[model samples]
Target: MIENIHFIAVALLIALGIYTLIFKRNLIKIAMGISILASGINLFLISLGYRAQGIAPIFTNAAIAASEVQAKMVLPAPQALTLTSIVISLAVTALMLSFAIIIYQKTGSLDATKSRRLKG
Candidate 1:
């Protein structure tokens, strides 16, 4: 059903990310691949909290109605965690990109093999 589709999507994203990271020689491409992998994991986590017949997690003090009972089925924790992860991932991506830019400026190349800082 829907679960199988989600699994396939997540698996494909992870596979592409791994391929990009391993096959791309450019640092920026590798960073982008890592970001893709992180995003896929985040999506999988959010999907895990989804219920086909559920509703939002809002509540009121009024007497519970049949509709309210039917609407009180969401899991907020996973959504919150995903939001936090997105913010953290943004920061990490910015930092990594900045470092890559610095490396490129210093060495004038995007290829990791051309960087001489590691040479003895």
Candidate 2:
């Protein structure tokens, strides 16, 4: 089913991100993996609120009564949470990249192992 495909894709993203985080030595790659992981979580949250032929939970002047709309409206909580997560992810990504830049400047390499050796 199409719904199952969405979840499968989300799982793939999460798996790939974790693999990258664990295996990649580059700081940038690790940051990208974190970003990808965040995206998967965001997608999963949004998908949880999906409904077939569901209407928006807005107060538009459509040909439907408020009571009827209540039954058909997609859950708004997931959507709001997704938006908040997006903003938080952006901040985290920015902070991570900035730290990567600083690390590269101090250690002259982006490899995680090399950077650790430089710390002592």
My TM-score estimates for the predictions, one after another, are: 0.85, 0.91
Q: Per-residue CA lDDT of candidate 1, range 52-88, in tens?
A: 7676776655346766675556878999999999999
Candidate 1, pairs of clashing residues: none
TM-score of 1: 0.85
> What TM-score quantifies how close candidate 2 is to the native fold?
0.91
lDDT, candidate 1, equals 0.84
